[model samples]
Target: MHVPDGFINAPVSVAAGAVAAGAVAVSLRGARRELGGTSHAEGGGERTAPLAGLVAAFIFAVQMLNFPVAAGTSGHLLGGALAAILVGPYTGVLCVSVVLLMQGILFADGGLTALGVNITVMGVVTVVVAYGLFRGLVKVLPRKRRSVTVASFAAALISVPAAACVFTAIYAIGGTTDVPVSKVLTAMVGVHVLIGIGEAVITMLTVGAVVAVRPDLVYGARGLTAPLKLRVGGELVDAEPAPVPVAARSPRAVWATGLVTALVLAGFVSFYASASPDGLEKVAADKGIDKNVEEHAAKDSPLADYGVKDISDARISGGLAGVIGVGVMVVAGTGIFWSLRRRGTTDATPTRVPESV
Candidate 1:
């Protein structure tokens, strides 16, 4: 959920900002290793570096579609589980953080003042919880593609309520006004539990689709099974590794397809998404959660409220804004990931060992 301005006090917000900053810093370092230490210049960076950018753009686009969850309440993709399964946890954190940054600066979907809170709750917390549980589940379940899908579902289902609880705790600590904390907690977690179901379904479907098409590209599926071995009368025989077929589409082609899908979702499909207030917004209104809510600083921006300022047609305005958002997200995310991937390669390269006397 995108926390609006005044949702959290300045002191707590600042503290959360520091936490978010540290998390991003650590994730940046971690993403390098997760990208397989491949620089684009070396022609070895296709695995997760570019795909990480696509993941970020895809999450941003999917989040625009708010599926109805209850009476007048809708839910969108948190995407921590989806990203973590598709990419690695560190890269997943970066993906969601980048989306939050774009939404805050370009779209004004989230409050700039509460940027740290949003990143902390939505990016760090959700990614950590989902990825942790996912790894745990994968260890216990059968080492199959289906197991990865199941783990992704369970991880996503839990992450939503976990985030809601975290927000409630934050509000409890730094709330701007007096309200029944218990009531807020109940409402927040209850509705989000239902929202979690939606999150799980989306995460499972997306992860499964990718696993089915290209299991090698899935980070969570790596190392799940060992090489084939046969047992004959108390003797173990190693079988030859099966020759894998080349993918029908090159990595660049797959990246292009994913980018196109993200654009289509944001630029067109979002037009028909439910217009109802999302879960957090609905809860805030019903429970007086925004008693001290302040106007966003960027309220008058051209793309504020997910629409262009002077565009008369609602569809055109929203479509243009969505397209602009997707484009910006792709360029920005790709730049960040590629730079990190290159830096990682340089750092990981071993220095020449001089001859010792």
Candidate 2:
């Protein structure tokens, strides 16, 4: 649901911009902890930074592959649920926000002026709702691999409609047109529910796959397995820690694999994505919610609309654009995460212990 320019009045858009800015500020601080703070000897920050970047790139690639939801409506991965499960909530928000930013300025998929709305709805709302519910479910459900996947599915499924409702509420307050709020709400929620199913399945499979290979890398699965307890005297004490697996200590393999997957998805598989309008696009057209929609400022960019400007072949043009997008996203995401991780590491540095007297 990338809100284009003119969908919201200036006042409300500015208000939403403030909210989005605040959310991003908070997420930046929170992401530092998620990236750097870990009890592992291998340094959680070092291992997690690259993975988080890959997650962002993967989300960008996946969003290009829109699956058909209704007769003429399609939906794509929001990435909040997947990112939160893979990384953390704060990082998840940043990931989606980065995607939205790139899409706006480069691809012209989302509007530059509406960046705030898109970030608030697609980035903030989806991550908060998905991660909060995911944590709750993880707490109640059995601590197992399956439980994480199941929780991911549920969280992703709910997050879509939750975002849709939030968008409807925002539009109700400052819609540029005279669309009925009730009708918009009903239609948005109804269609997004189906879209959520697609989100859930994708989340479930992706989380399950990652968990199967490296559960330790998955933030949601981090503490799922409790430490072994040993009875000593009348009390139970934690057993000695197990050695870190050789494979788990390094993220290079996983990073390479993930990057390759993202490249393939965006560079090739996206060509098969449905041509139908997405849920929000369809709703806007049908309900006249886009009556005042303005043209994208970057409409003339070489990569606008996910196609190369002078490339005659649709396949080559789209694929080149997609590849470029993935590359840029990976570099941008990794740089941001690495900076956060460095700051976290500095903050978490220990004071020098006094040498033995």
Candidate 3:
């Protein structure tokens, strides 16, 4: 849900921009520790960079496939928890940032002037809420492979509503039009609650699959203890073996997988996506908050609203956007991750070694 320029008043949008800036600042510092301190340098540098990009592109494509939830309303995966769990929280924020950027600049999905608001609502808030809940649940629940999946589900479910609350609050403050704040809050929270369930299911399945195949790579699942402890002599220890470093995929494999997933989701699957208004649209309409909704600055652009100018076929126009978005995200994410990964490698390398013993 990208908030266009006019929905939120100028004052509120500027305030949101400041908050977003601070959060991004914090995330950059936090990411160094998460990536450098935790992940294996060789593998992380080589693999994580490309993988992060793929994750962003993946989130973008998946978001296009909005599902029908209720009459006049639809829900799409916001993908904060999904990205955070797969990669890391800092990187997840960046992933969502990249998606918003592409949407605002190229596809006119969101407003350029309101890009900060969209990133703050969809990226920063979602990751913070999702990661916080996931960590808390993991601590209390029995640690198992399913625990990660379960935690992911719970986190994603909660995160969507949390984002809705945030948006509602923002509207309460800087809403350009007069509307009842209580009604907006109630509607925003209510519809988002249903959307949360769908988010949870998708997150659970995705996390479960990754944990099954490459548990070690899951940033959230790191250091997870097995549910059952084994008795060894007198004391007990985790039944699971220590995770080994998984090898990076061949370059061809990474390239092929990311591209293919982006293509399928954007091109074909998008056709089946629900036509109903998304969470933001529904809330805006019902709450009368969209009375001042401004047309996007890039409204006249060729790629406006994820369509090409000359393309008569809706499928083809959207398909091209999906592809281009994927390409852009992959390149951008790869660049950022690659730099972080390289820094990690540089830090890990020994400056000097003994020549003789």
Top-scoring candidate (lDDT): 2
lDDT of 3: 0.80
Pairs that collide in candidate 3 are: none
Q: Assess each prediction's global lDDT (C-alpha) against the native.
A: 0.88, 0.91, 0.80
**Model 2 residue pairs with clashes:** none
lDDT per residue (tens digit) for residues 288-308 in model 2: 999899999999999999999
Q: Report how far off residue 36 is in candidate 3 (Å).
A: 3.4
Model 1: residues >4 Å from true position, as ranges?
38-45, 229-244, 247-249
How are the candidates ranked when ordered by lDDT, highest leading? Answer: 2, 1, 3
TM-score of candidate 3 against the unseen true structure: 0.88
How many steric clashes between backbone atoms does each model show? Answer: 0, 0, 0
Compare candidates 1 and 3 on TM-score and give the better one: 1
Descending-TM-score candidate ranking: 2, 1, 3
lDDT of model 3 at position 89:
92
Per-residue lDDT of 1-357 in model 1, one digit per residue for the tens?
899999889999999999999999999988888875454223244578888889999999899999999989999999888888888999999999999988988788888989999999999999999999999999999999999999999999999999999999999999887878998899999999999999999899888988887676788888677768899888998776554457634667668888898889888999999999988899899999798899888888889888989989988888788888888888899899988888887888989999999
Candidate 3 per-residue C-alpha lDDT over 132-248 given as tens digits, one digit per residue, 9 for 90 to 100:
999999999887888899899999999999999998888888888888889998998999999989888888887786677667667888768534588999999767654554554
Q: How many backbone clashes does candidate 2 have?
A: 0
**Weakest ten-residue segment in model 2 by summed lDDT:** 37-46
